[model samples]
Target: MTSTILNPYLEGNFAPVPDEVSVGDLPVTGTLPRELNGRYLRVGPNPTGPAATDVNHHWFAAHGMVHGVRLRDGRAEWYRNRFVQGDAPNHSPNTNILAHGGRLLALVEGGRPPVSIAPDLNRMATWDCDGALRGGVTAHPKIDPASGELHSVTYLLRPGSEHLRYVVIDATGKATHTAELPVPGVPLVHDMALTDTRVVVLDLPVTLSMAAAARVASGTPESGGEFPMRWTEEHPSRVGVLPRGGTAEQLRWFDAPRCYVFHVLNAYDNPDGSITMDVCRYDTVFRDEYRGPADVLPALARWTIDPARGTVSEQIMSDHSVEWPRIGPELVGRPHRYGWFGGIGADGLHLSDDVNRVRGGSLEPGPLVKFDTTTGEISTHHFGIGRVTQEPAFVPRPGAEAEDDGWILSVVHDAATDHSELVVLDAADVEADPIARVHLPRRVPFGFHGNWIADNDIGE
Candidate 1:
C-alpha cells in the first residue's frame, strides 16, 4: 500500500483526523456578540482509513465529516466533530449543510441521499423527503426567503439516464413538485440560480465521458482517476430557463459560451422581460485532465438572459479568482446589491504550477472578498501567509437594516500552528481585523459550504 503522505489531498490541513472530538467552553480572542446565538457548522470530505494508492482517489471521494462550534451569551461554547452516518457505500456527504423543514441535512451533489443529523452533530437516518426524491439531490438548493420553499435541479448518474429532475420541497419539508427535463448528456449541474419567477439551469460542456471512465478503470497515470467526467469540445454549452411553477414543455433553452459555473451569487427578474444572474464563471473545468487544481481560475460575472431574443449576455465583474459567492439569506431569489466570496489573494501563494500538479495542493484559500454590485467595487480581507480560510457565511445581526449589516463567519486554518479558528468580521467593514477569533482544538480541513443555524431556528 502506498502511503497517503504523498497524496496532496491526505496531507497537511487537508488530511483527515483520526478520531471525533468534543470540547466545551473553547477559548476566544475577542468578545462574542451577545445577540448572536447559534451553531457554526461545516461539512467536508474526510477519508475513513488510509488512502489507497491503487484506488485513484479524488479529493471529493472521501467520507463526510462535520465540525461545529456553538455560540451563545457573548461567549464561546462547545465544539464537536463527528462523521455523518449514512447508508451509501462511500458515505461521503462532504458538500453543503443546511436546514430545511426544521431538519438539518448534510448534502452531496449526486449519487446518494442526504443524511439528517441532530443539532448536536449526532447522525440520524438517511432522508428521502418521505420518498418524494426520485434521485440524488443537489447540494446547492435555493430557499426562497419570502415563500419559505426550497428548489433544486437534481440528476442521477445511473446508466441509460438522459434526463434531469426539477424538484421543489415545500416549507414544511414535503416534496411538492418533480419534473423530468430531457438533456443530451449527463452534464454536471453542481449548482443552479433562482429568481422570483424563474429557475436558471446550466448545461455546460463538461459531461460524463466513457473514454475517461475506461482510462481510470485501467489505472492510466494521466487519467484524473477519481471522477470519470471530463470536458468535451463536442458538448453544446447552453442554459435553460423554466417557470417557477411550470413544467419541461415551457422550458426555453438559450445558447451560452463554452464555460462552467460552480456557484451562482444571486439572480433576479427584470422588468424588461429579462433575467440577471451573478456567478463565479470559470473559463473551463475538468478539461484536459482532472489530476489537480484547475488550470483556469473563476471570476465573478454577470449573465443577462433575454428570453425574447433567446440569447445570453455575459460581463466580467472582477478579474480576481473567487468562489463560494454568498449574499444575505433574505435576498435569495430577489434583487441584491452586496455579495461576499472567498478567493486567492494578491500574494498568489498557492497558484504556482508546482502546487497545481498535486491533488489538493492549492488548499490555501487566501482572502475574503466583498463585492458591491451597486458601485462595482471590490474589497477584501487578506489573512497573510500560512493562514487559509474557507467559505464565508454571512450572519445578519439582530434588527439589521442594511443588506451588508452582519458578521462574516469563516473557519481559518493556521499552518504555522496546525490549528483552526472561527473568525468573525463585520460584513460592513470586511477589510478590518476580525471582531472575534474562537480557537479550535484542531485544524478544520478545506471543505465546502456551511451555515450559521441560529438558536431559535434549531428544532426543539
Candidate 2:
C-alpha cells in the first residue's frame, strides 16, 4: 500500500473528511454567551478509509473523528460529525475529548478502551470504567479541579510489558484506584502531571521499538511503521513522583534531561518542598525522523522537582514556538498565573511535504498565545493570513472572579477557505478581535484535545 502518492498525512490541511455531517443552527459571528450553555468538544485523527500507505501511515495513527459545536441560551447550537465507535469496527478514538464522571469520554493513548460518546455525536460503548479499565486509556486524563478525580497514567503495548498503569476515576464515575509501575522500557507515556499531593510520571526516552515489532511480524514494507516508537539512547530520562493514593513502591524517580514531553502546562505543590512542572519541551522524540515527527521545536519548560535532593531543575519558560497548553479548569491541581498556547507561525508556514517530511519544512501555526506566569508577559491572538490554530478551551465566566475570567475556546483553521471556525477569545483580552466566530461546516482536520462541557455538566 505504500503509495498514497507519497502520503504527507493525506495531503492539504491534513485532509481526511469523507462525510459524517449533521448540521442545524450553526452560523454565528459574535455574541454566544448566555453563560455559554454547553458542548464544544473536539477530537482529531480522521482516516476512515484509504489510509495504509505503509510505513504504518501516521498522523498519530488516524481514524477517530469527532467535531461538535452546540452552545446555547445565546444561540449557535447544532453542528456535528461522528465516527468514534471503538471496541472493534476500526476503533479509533483519536486523542482527547473530556467530560468525565458524567461520562462522554473518547480518548486514545496506547490503543482502544475509552469511547462512550453521545452528547449527540453518538457512538456509545467500549468503556472499561466498570471493569476498572484493563487495556488502555490516557488521552491526557487529569480532571481533579478539587477532587473531581479522573487522573490516569495507563500504558500497555504488550510484548514483555514492564509495567505502567495508575488510574483513579472517583468523583462518582468510579474506578477508584489501580496501580502497577515498574517500567524501564515500554515508554512513550504521553502526558501526565497532576498535583495536590502528586502523580507526575514521564519515564521518557521513547521506547517500544522491538525492531518495529519485528517488522510487523515479518510482513515488511516500510516495516510495520505507524510509530512503533524508538528513540532510545539507552533509555533512562526519569521523573516519576507518584503518591496521590500511593503504590508502585511509592515512586520518586527524578533525573530528567533527555527531553520529550507531549504536553503538560500545569502542575504544583511547591511551598518549600518543591515540585513544579509546565512542559512542552521536546529536544528529541521518535528520533532523527522515521517518516514523521521529530523535526524539533517545542519550548516552554520549567521543571523543578527535588524529592529531597534527588534533583530535577530545568527552566526554559518561553522563547516562543509553543504547543497546546491551557489552564483554568480551576487550575487543575493548583497554582497558575495564566497560560494558553498554540502559536508557531514564523513566515509563510508549511507542513505537508507529504505531511511534515520536514525537508524544506513548514508547520506555521501562528497565534493565540498568552502567558504571564506572573510577569514574564507575552500575549498574542493573530488569526490572519491563511490562519491555523487549535487547543485553547479555557471557558470559565459564569459569575467568574479574576484568574483569567473566561472564554477562549479555539478551533480556527482557514487556509484560505478550506474552512473551520469556532474562535471566541477574550480570556482577559487576548489582544482582542473575536469574541465569537463559530462557523464550521467542514474542514476541521488537525485535532488533539478539547473540552468545555457545562450545561450543568451534561448527564441526564
Candidate 3:
C-alpha cells in the first residue's frame, strides 16, 4: 500500500495571524426562513444488480449567501460578511457557483446522468446528478455589481430520462426563464461567465452518433462519441448572453472553439471597452471513458467579447497551457483577476511521464499568474509544486488603500494527505509566502469554483 502525505513548502514561520482575514465554519443557516428542511431521500445503487456502494448517492455541498437588492431606488450592495446562507446539499457533477444579478444562480451542466457505461467507465454513483433534476442548477450565479441583479444557468432533466433542457434563474432565486438549446448532439454547460449586462456559457456538445451509443451500451471504449470527435475546433461551443431584466432576454450568441470540459474563471469589463474571460480545458479522453487522467497543459485562452461586432476575439498572451487565469490587481484596467488550479507545462513540476499521460498531470501546482492585458506584462508567483492550489478570490482593501495590490484568498491543498487549508496571500507578490493558513479539520473535496459571501446584510 502507498500513502500520499505532502506538505506545502513554507518560507516564513507557519504561524497564525492574530487579526488576519478569516472566515468561520458554520453549518447551513437561513434555510428555515424558506420553510425548507435540510433533508433528502437519496437513491441507492441496485442491490440485485451489483454489490457496490450506493450508486446514486446525493448530498448537499455548499450554501451561498443571497444577494441583497433595493428595488425601490435601485440601490445595490454586495455581501462582505463571511457566512454562507441556505443549504447546498448536492454537489453539482459539472457546475460552478457565482454571484450574479441581484441574486445567486447555480448553473449546471445539462445532459444525461452518469451511468455504468463500461468496465472502465464505471457506473456513476446513483447520487451523482441528484438535486432538482427537472432543472438541475450548476453554473455559478453572477451578480451585476452595478445593478445588484444576479443570474444563474442550469440544465433540466425529467426523472428517469436524458432529455436535457436549458434554464436561467433571475436574482430572486426563481427560475424565471427557460429555453431549449437543442442540437442533434448532447451539450453540457461546464462553466459560465458574466459581465455587467450579459452572461456567457462555455458549452461542450458531444455528438454521440447512434453507432457510438450502441457501443457504449454494449460496454467498450472503442465506442461512445469518437475518442476525440471532430470537436468544432473553430467553433466548438456557443456563448449565450442574456439581459439582466427585460424578460431575461438573450442579448446574443457567439460561436467559439470547443471548451472541452473546462470552467470559465471570471468575466469582467475592460477599460478599453472589452469583455475578458479565462478557462481551463482537458483535451484528452481516458481508456475508461468516464474519468480522464489529468494530462497536458491547460491553455489559458483569452477572449474579448465585443458588443459592437457581437463576437469574441482571442487575446494574444506569452504562453498557453495555463489553468485558472483570473482578473486581479494586475488586471486593474480589466476589473477582475482570473485564477485556477493545475501546473504549468515546461516547468519542473510535470516530472513523471505517467503524470503527463493523464489529462491534468505533467506540471506541478502552478504559480498564481496575473497578466495585465493592457500592457502585456504578466506577474507570476508559483505557490510551490506539491501543493494543489485551487481558485483564488481577490479581496479589495478598504478605503484609501493602494488599489494596485489586494489580498488573495486561495484554497491550498496538501497533495500528500489530501488535506486543504485556507491561505491568504498578498495580491501584489505571488512569490511572497502565504500571509496565513487556516487549516481545515477535514479535507474538502476538490471543488470547481467559489466566491466571497459577506454575512451582515442577510438579515436586513
| Candidate maximizing TM-score | 1
lDDT of 1 at 159: 44
Off by over 4 Å in 3: 1-108, 111-134, 157-184, 203-236, 241-253, 258-261, 268-276, 281-290, 293-295, 306-311, 328-364, 400-404, 415-418, 457-460
**Roughly what TM-score does model 1 have, to 2 decimal places?**
0.93
215-291: candidate 2 lDDT, tens digit per residue: 75686566533667878888989889978878888887988877888899989998887888889887886676654
Off by over 4 Å in 2: 1-27, 31-202, 205-208, 213-225, 230-237, 240-261, 267-273, 278-304, 307-325, 328-390, 393-402, 405-407, 412-420, 425-435, 449-460
**What TM-score do all the candidates reach, one by one?**
0.93, 0.32, 0.58
lDDT of 3: 0.40
Worst 10 residues of 1 by lDDT: 346-355
Greater lDDT among 1 and 2 belongs to 1
138-164: candidate 1 lDDT, tens digit per residue: 989999998988998977764456988
Alpha carbon lDDT at 16, candidate 2: 74
Q: Quantify all predictions' global Cα lDDT against the true fold.
A: 0.81, 0.78, 0.40
Worst 10 residues of 2 by lDDT: 346-355
Q: Could you tell me the TM-score of candidate 2?
A: 0.32
